[model samples]
Target: MPNSDMPQTRQHCYAYPHPAVTTDVVLFTIRQRTLSVLLIQRGTPPCQGMWALPGGFLEIDEDLETCAKRELYEETGIEGVYLEQLYTFGDPQRDPRERVISVTYFALSQSDNLSPKAASDAALADWFSMNELPQLAFDHAKIIQLARTRLLSKLGYSTIAFQMLPEYFTLSQLQSVYEILLDENLDKRNFRKGILARNIIKETGEYSRLGNHRPAKTYQVVNPSQVEIIK
Candidate 1:
């Protein structure tokens, strides 16, 4: 006989062991005309000392995206950037320690604004060029490849590239970001024509005097929330 006001203890309904869940982040940025990714060196075992995407096990109290953001901040000291869930890796053999599943997220940020300091389970955090990445832990290399594919595909239809630029930038500066991500040089005439046709950006009537050349007119996204696919 228990008091009606007292909390009741719930009995276990099943005894099957559940797979441990984790979150990983793939942070990308453009620097010096090159696209790069943020990676951390693991300090703990099961691929200790290897470069891996910043991540950790999910906590019971957190949601998937919340866990991903928390792990990114804990490992690289980076927070408050645009993060989108990339994919899930559930291969039973992906992790050496028991059965684990990973929900990975990809983030975009301006490289000039980020200065990663390794913390938590990370021994070191640094940016690496997409073409010259070190050996990665787990299936992180596969995850990065998938992220790159997603980014390239999205560039044609979304305003995501703006995330790597400042609030106001010149057309040339914007083109460089595209060139870096696409890994190819674009014809200036055609590029400008296409961009103007799409009407995605608005001229700010401001010019950049940072370089020796004549000032270039600055522009910014007309509607940051709108997606006008590039032709």
Candidate 2:
């Protein structure tokens, strides 16, 4: 047997096997308790012209979160917000063209008065309610489900719901968002007590003057930096 110190005649270079790692962002916003996800129309083959989440290949030096935010802004003109890592998808055949792996991030944003501008390779970008989604390309549908589950779990104890609301809103409006996301009715008094008890919200001294009944007082999530869990 050759001495262990002897070098082998064969040469081997490190190669990145299969498809490269990529990143996908599931940007969600809530309007009237209806959850909406941002999607872009693809401009190339493999899923050309189909709707998909805003995402792209990661740069060699880019971190996962950095890639996600860059992709979000490049594809949908969205920026500067709370983004949480959700999951990674690495099915060998997930991408027809290559064995691409994707790290998915879920981003929350205020649903009111924010419109997306299509950029990058996206010909069009728009927010679609989870219920009314068109056929999504790739494993994006699955990614959305994963994000939804994480969001719901977080809502039980975290003030994550406010990420989808405006700076000032009525209690009913906030409650509606909770009901929609949780898919259940929350007792008004109980909800109020829980919310007030948390001390994470502040009265805005504003009211919704256009409602059928007397205008409800408006409030906003206080301590924007607080990440209180409801549970």
In model 1, the Cα lDDT at residue 199 comes to 81
Task: Look at candidate 2 and tell me the lDDT of residue 157.
Answer: 75
Model 1 agreement with the true structure over 1-231: per-residue lDDT tens digits: 779999989887777989999999999999777899999999999999999999999998899999998898999999978888899999999999989999999999888789999999899999999999999999999999999999999998888999898889988988899999999999998988888888889999888976689988999998765444665
Residue-level lDDT of model 2, residues 111-217, one tens digit each, is 65467899989989998998999999999999999999999889877888887777788888888888988888989999999888888888988778755789889
Candidate 2 to truth, TM: 0.87
TM-scores of all models?
0.94, 0.87
Give me the overall lDDT of model 1: 0.91
Please name the candidate that would achieve the greatest lDDT relative to the true structure.
1
Cα error of candidate 1 at position 146, Å:
0.6
Candidate 1: segments with Cα more than 4 A from true spot:
4-9, 225-231
Candidate 2: list runs displaced more than 4 Å.
Answer: 1-12, 15-19, 205-208
